[model samples]
Target: MARRALLTDRERELIEGGGDTDDELRYQAVSRVRRKIQEELTEDIDILRENHPDLYAELREVVCESN
Candidate 1:
């Protein structure tokens, strides 16, 4: 199954200059939206792992472990 795209209409509008014009304000908005997207992506990855245990196990093996 294809992954669902992130970013809501409001977020897209903000990114496309449909929101604040001030540099600082725009930066804050973009930063907030970016963080939200990252969180959603992490959640989606977790759900995929839950649905496919073998794939998840292989992925864990490939990922380097930290001390």
Candidate 2:
């Protein structure tokens, strides 16, 4: 079965300016995506970091340490 996306295509478009072609479009998309992720996840992340440090660290290490 196909997995569902956490964010919808409309959400992506709203965040990404609808696939605009410009020199700065990639940069804009990256900035917008990063900012949106931080905005949406920061609160829950903070709570998890404080209350469930192990799980938080595991997730953080997986996402951050992979690269």
Candidate 3:
């Protein structure tokens, strides 16, 4: 299933405003959302590692280069 892109309230307003917003603001807002998503994914991975070690091992095998 496709998920909606996460956006801050300010980002939502800027998008709804229809232009005139600064480019730097757009970049910062996008960066904020990207960081939030990364943090959430990392937390979920940690939980999976503790609760489902075998599955986490398989995931690590596919995703980790050094491990």
Best-performing candidate as measured by lDDT: 3
TM-score of each: 0.45, 0.48, 0.45
Local accuracy of candidate 3 as per-residue lDDT tens digits, 1-67: 6445466568776645556888777777777767876997678679989999997897678778665
lDDT of 1 by residue, 1-57 (tens): 544346555555666774445666567778987886588657766976989878777
lDDT of 1 at 56: 74
* Candidate 2 overall lDDT versus native: 0.68
Report the alpha-carbon TM-score of model 1 versus the true structure. 0.45
**Candidate 2: count of backbone clashes, pairs at least 3 residues apart or interchain:** 0
Candidate 2: tens digits of C-alpha lDDT, residues 2-65: 4543455544555555456463655666676677678867876888899999989987998798
After superposition, candidate 2 runs with Cα above 4 Å error:
1-32
Which is the leading candidate under TM-score? 2
All candidates' lDDT scores? 0.67, 0.68, 0.74
TM-score of candidate 3 to 2 decimals = 0.45
